[model samples]
Target: MESADETNTKLNGKSPSPVRSTRPKRSVRLTVKPKCFRCDKCKCEFSDQTNLDYHVSIHATDKPFHCETCQLLFSKRASLKAHVRTHSAAASAAKKKVFKCDNCGSKFTTSSHLKRHTRTHTGEKPFVCDVCGSKFTQNSHLKSHARKHTTDKLFACKNCPSKFSRGSDLKAHVRSHVVEKTLKCDSCDAKFSKKSHLVRHKRKHSGERPFHCDQCAAAFPENYMLKRHMRRHSGEKLFHCDICGSKFLEKLYLKRHMYTHSTEKPFHCDTCGSNFSQKIYLKSHMLVHNGEKRYQCEMCDSKFLRRQHLTIHIRKHTGERPHQCTICLSKFLTSSNLKTHLRTHTGEKPYHCDTCGSNFSENSTLKDHMRTHTGEKPFWCSICGSSFIKNSNLKSHMRKHTGEKPFHCNICASDFSQSSSLKKHMQTHLNKYQPL
Candidate 1:
């Protein structure tokens, strides 16, 4: 080239082209890299150190970010932002116009909720389970019903062999094992896992029966108790015992009935080395050792270890005999008393002695009959050092020293120490009014 500028001018302002190279072009390839950063606790892999650090903060107890609306703490700002949306949604829901059901007069926030509620009155089940063929009112209910057929139980209890399909059921089961019963009754030495249970227990001490029955004058502390009382009026026995084929109004009654068939006593008393089939029975038995009478009668100086015993004792003063015999029209304070009275009419001696082959209507009478064979005199007098097989015999013998006449005759107005003596005294009046 003579001169680069002079050659461009002569060629009409055009430069000469460069020569082509015959070198092979190097091929460049792009590949995805494996995640190197991992968490020590949960073994979660992260692509970068920044993402791994954010995930690691979740395992820490310290929560730096907090929601301004509910004061709920969160580990990250993103979690706080997600929680703030719930408050915003709730605020929006509060401002929404309510939709009312004409049939039941039930109010709902949305038209969709009212439509779902209307199915209850119409007995309409739109959603059907594909596996079990069970119909449900809603899709969510059908999804829940579908879980019963599924073998996949995602949530499992860490402490026990119990596995649940739902995380909520697993959480509830976990509470049975590791429960912090912080809610305690101030009236008695009773602790509860929930505040609602503690509140219900407090009603017993306060004598506050807020839930009343519409059919009868009976009142209860809880709504469930009121429902159970209503079943007595309806004569509905929903729960049935598998072993004895006995039916009960409530599941609690059936559970207690099952204990009669069971030889295993799970609850043990440390004081007397006594065992009970139920924990509640063991709890009531513990009061005998501790001499703790928590329940007291308002009308009299009578104090009882159990609330039901106090309730029965109060009936003595008020004369509120709710349980009545249909045959004799005789009234009783408790259902158990009415049941025992019915046995007299039916001649059903359920309790039998294995040693003597003798039968008794009451279990306590059978227990006393067993004492005759064992020669066990449990009741003893403190003054005279006299022992008796039956506690009633010991009580009657004690009257000889103190001289207390409890049983009285309505005809002669004469009092006797024992009921048998009063019955014999009443025979004298029958002889006086003889038609000979």
Candidate 2:
């Protein structure tokens, strides 16, 4: 046998020692040569050296890496690479329930979210707040909260000239600007913004209201939305008004009320000259202007600006009499509606016509009806000298008198009093009805 140093000389073509060796010797003296053995059938050595017994046909046939959970097996290197995922998934399922957070009491379907949340209680904020000396568990929470100070609003809306600090907030804000939501439900073809929004909007489509209020028995699609609604019954005014003793359940509502006290008409409708403090208020006001009622009564198919309005609209159809008129035994859906109804019985039309002796249900309604008598058209049509109750009504009513109908029909030359009416009339040709 050749010496260890002589064996190196043969492997490297250089002599380190005078002693001759054929095979190179290792200092550790490994018992195994880490090489494949020759098979008797073919008299060939295997190429793979990781497992010398891989050359054995019987041992190579059994894939020990088979996943019990996924029941996947592998024979080749490529197949084993694919099959290892099943073992990893099974291992992940095993490690899932083991490491959990004690703070938020959240269970992770994967250990990643639990790991991220654990950093909160450990005072390990991987995400640091640049604004104040605050730290958060999520980068998104830091991103959204940062908008309160800096106006680095980068998220621009595709529909409108609006920007938001956060991408999700921008997505949510864009929903209020447009009437259409392209993302439809799998169960029902209802459209909405986010998946959660789609889920909530689906309740409007299927009427599958699951969350019910304990205090007033009012139902909502989402539990969080229901929690916000429950504050109405609980009278838990969490959002306190800075100006007065008044408080609101919603922060947005309180913000809008602050505008009312300040008379700050921030948002304005481009189509109609109507102004509003809240974006939703502007959108709802456009309903009266365009005569576009997206929300329809579940019973009568009559439309309204809001779901609450539609809920009120359904009482007229269901006749599930809610409010009782204490004076005249008349049962109505709303207290204000009953109060308006009582005026007809009592002949106490507080809202009187200045030009005629006509009394009405509501003061605004009476004010509106007075215009018909007095011809005092405060809402003048630019196309014609027609005055009306609201500027939007005047615009709609002007189309009826002017014969200059801008909203033309694809099927016919039919004109309408309102743009909404023209759109609905055009739908007659396509036979396209509102989807639920």
Candidate 3:
């Protein structure tokens, strides 16, 4: 304490200073790294080089990140990872709980799905769009409807100039470019691009109509057909033709009606070298060449090439006149007959002959009238090779070859091949009974 340490402590009442390091101190070198990695497209900046490269990949047309579970592709790996999780979650949830709707007995994996399905029966539309004020049963459907208000088309066709707001619509449009139809019908030569279309086509051969309408006794092979049938009851013609301003119940009917505007026949028949405006018309024409009467009437020996013709022919035996006129209350066997009958009341002669300036209420009548200008006799007798303008004329001429006297007089009980001949014979009986 009385030494140099005590003298230094007594002077300031403190201890001596600590010794410092002799080696050079290292500087921290605080460098603020700027976002040097900038994207050429969109001009997005990122601190990390890997993140910038990922952001640039989004602008590329090709999607490198592939989901093995669903064959879905994404631009970013993170998005692919998230989509993979959804597949896993769906698989797991399917195995776990199965939520069912009490009203419709529809089974779904999640309670949310069951709730959304319950809205179909209850007619509950909880989600409403702010833009168009349209209501939807689910939030996802509302989101889809909201896209109609915006002009932003995110999805575009690579092969065409068509752009779609929805990815599903773009996917459906891409199917048009597919040249080959993978789904083939085992019963017929009909081929389809989609499995659903093939399944529906097979129903035509099997006569399996699973879908039924609640409002009527009508049944259809597909659910869409049942939905289309409901439009008849509603009297809703939503689909419109731009050329003729004609409205149709369905888009398919509108599409078929569009062919009337143009003389171009795109569909060709390979067998007869004939052309048709629609593919369905070509298909129906091919049945004539093949002589394939697949549909047969059980009530009579008469057979028809088409199922609809057989259905109408069966109604003749049943006397079931379902279609009725609202104005005159006249019942018709078929809808076409009713439509033609209505034209008689309205005096709507839509079909006109360009050559003769003659008008006809029915298109078939116009076609027959056009033959007068062209001097075309399509109907021919097989026995005598005699041609006629109308099918009725050919049918009447066929009785000469077959010796068929269908018309009989009640007075003389004499049979005549033609009705005109029977009328002339009835006059002969009347002349004999006259007082001389």
Candidate 4:
């Protein structure tokens, strides 16, 4: 039987042990059991001794492999070798000369990177996840995607109470809490947390549409946008609301839609003391108090607090009714307007009043009907001490205070505040001009 010192000498190819063995030099033909190496930190068991040695080094602070350019230490020599390429790639990028892709004319510092880019044209996904069978062109993407299957959250945020599986995602999330935006666009004053976000923003300025849909002629600036657009053709709604049984194109939209079902309003307005289910709704409502209209129409002098409102206003000038009803053949400027029109045809009154037990097709109409029961007069006249349930009625009442008559008679040029009053005044002229 060989000694432990003799085994170490055989494994490492080093000199013989300095200390003498206490055991007798006897040929012990004992049955040798297979050794199972277990990691103390992660509690992972390995059959191979070489694999266990590599796994144990990851938990240690002292790294044997170090990059010469960045001086960044790595536990494994392969990781250090990979880190050296980033330095050489950056240096080659400064020279503006590298291996170019013949298909897309995209340049890469390394031939390996150029080969990976060529896979985009070839529609090849070499790396695949074993757990979920998800494929990717790069091995790094497959490793990142594999984290979704695991329950481990190795990276934790210091600023917020959040954890991430990947260190890169944690770093990106940390920037959201901090005001620091390191990446800035060259053409615009817009800044972003990551270089990828800055690159995506720059595409808006450059009018570059890199990702194109194979099914249709639609193209997008980003791959995620193209993936989202592909869902329209595929008729795939990945997210669904359990309460209303309504499906949505995106997960974020479904999360926002869930706020409607929630009775609790966490976000409160400081000015009006109004509560909102979501923080974004409260932020938008705050713009009304501040009178901030950031979005403006290019075709008209109309301005809106929200971009969606500005987009709807632009359709009035352009006469572009993109939303069409299949049942009535009616066109609408916005999807909300089309939805309301569909409710009229289908008799789908979604908005219901709890107090009166009355249902309304439109939410605005239900809100107005709610004022009747609650006696909540939100609109108020500044000139008089009068309050109104509707804003349109308040505007009509304001015309009486200002003495500005909008409704005028064509014959006598007589003006009136209310349209009904003008119609009654026109009857007097009609009686005078009657052939008796």
- All candidates' TM-scores? 0.44, 0.28, 0.49, 0.46
Cα lDDT tens digits for candidate 3, 1-436: 3999779888999987878989999988987778988776445678889888877766565566776543456877888898889867865774665686676454567777667656655666788889867666678877887888888876767778888887788778978886568778998989986455676687789998876665468888866687688667544454655444456888888889877644468998887576788999998898898877878888778988988899989989999999999999999999889988998998988776677777778777876776788798878888889999899999999998899999999987999999999999999989988999
- The per-residue C-alpha lDDT of model 2 at residue 276 equals 73
- After superposition on all C-alphas, the RMSD of every candidate to the true structure, in Å, is 18.4, 26.0, 17.0, 17.0
Q: What does candidate 2's lDDT look like per residue over 121-164, in tens digits?
A: 46455666776755555687577667778766666666677766
Q: Global CA lDDT of candidate 1, please?
A: 0.77
Off by over 4 Å in 4: 1-213, 216-229, 242-245, 261-264, 291-300, 404-436
Q: Which ten residues in a row have the lowest lDDT in candidate 2?
A: 64-73
- Report model 3's TM-score to 2 decimal places: 0.49
User: Which runs in model 2 stand beyond 4 Å of their true positions?
Assistant: 1-233, 238-247, 286-301, 304-306, 324-332, 335-378, 381-384, 388-436
Per-prediction tally of clashes: 0, 1, 0, 0
Better of 2 and 3 by TM-score: 3
Q: List the residue pairs that clash in candidate 3.
A: none
Model 4 C-alpha lDDT per residue in residues 202-260, reported as the tens digit of each score: 77899888666654689888767987996665444546565555568899999998876
Judging by TM-score, tell me the better candidate of 1 and 4: 4
For model 1, the superposed segments whose C-alpha errors exceed 4 Å read 1-245, 249-252, 261-275, 409-414, 426-436
